[model samples]
Target: MSETRKCMVCGQIFKLRAQCPHQRYCSNRDCQRERKAQWQKLKVKSDPDYRENQRRAQTRWSELHPDYWRRYRDMHQAYKERNREQQRVRNSQSRQVAKMDVSVLDSRLCSGLYVLTHAVCGDVAKIGAWIVHLTVISDLPVESLKIAKR
Candidate 1:
């Protein structure tokens, strides 16, 4: 058996394995989380000027390296797509039934006026009913409106 080495992470002594050499943490997740937390703490403690410099350096690097920037963007997009798909699957599994509320329509205008207008127009039959209604009520000409499809 090979000699044991101390883990820099939890400070636990572990036997050297054939797969990994100088392993700081037992698993990849533990190592990644520790590194992320360490960097986050460092960033928090860093001066404003230092953070600005780092941001500028990153921007300059991306500007100077188009290929690197493209690859990084592609990888980020792929990761986002995968994560979104996983979230959609998980959400679809725990589907819930929601009830819609029905309320009575109360209008201050007289019922006779409402009935005459509704009779002249079949329940505001088209998309631009509000505009048309306003035009008709205000004695304005209804212009030929071109409705765009979404």
Candidate 2:
């Protein structure tokens, strides 16, 4: 009986092929693709000639199909919408705003009670807002104070 080994890519047990002794990845399409991708990544990082060849091939392909992505997006409405939504999420995450309690940079605000409301619908600090953790002790009307919560 042939010896069995675990596939490196998917961690599945696979019988060692008689033809290929050093097969580390499974025969699954995704695993094969991942193996190729890893090999290409290492090749590109280590071999300048391979990197240049890949770049040239990409440039050639781009030249041949200048509007490929535009046509693809037009044809695949769901893909375009999904990409737009993902980009919005990325933009929100990348915005230069704090995700935690606001740092007390300036001592301009008075030492009094305050309320902090969400700048937007959700409590995310990717956008600008004055926030701090607040506890209302007095029966102050809802018309008062800056608050930040962790």
Per-candidate TM-scores read 0.32, 0.53
Q: Residue 39 error for model 2, in Å?
A: 1.0
* TM value for model 1: 0.32
Error of 1 at 109 (Å): 20
Top-TM-score structure, candidate number: 2
Question: Residue 90 of model 1: what lDDT?
Answer: 79
Q: Which candidate is the best by lDDT?
A: 2
Pairs of residues at least 3 apart in sequence or in different chains that clash in candidate 1: none
Off by over 4 Å in 2: 85-150
Candidate 2, residues 1-150, lDDT tens digits: the string is: 998999888999998889999989889999999999999999999999999999999999999999999999999999999999999999987765565445754465445555565343455535555555454454444357345668
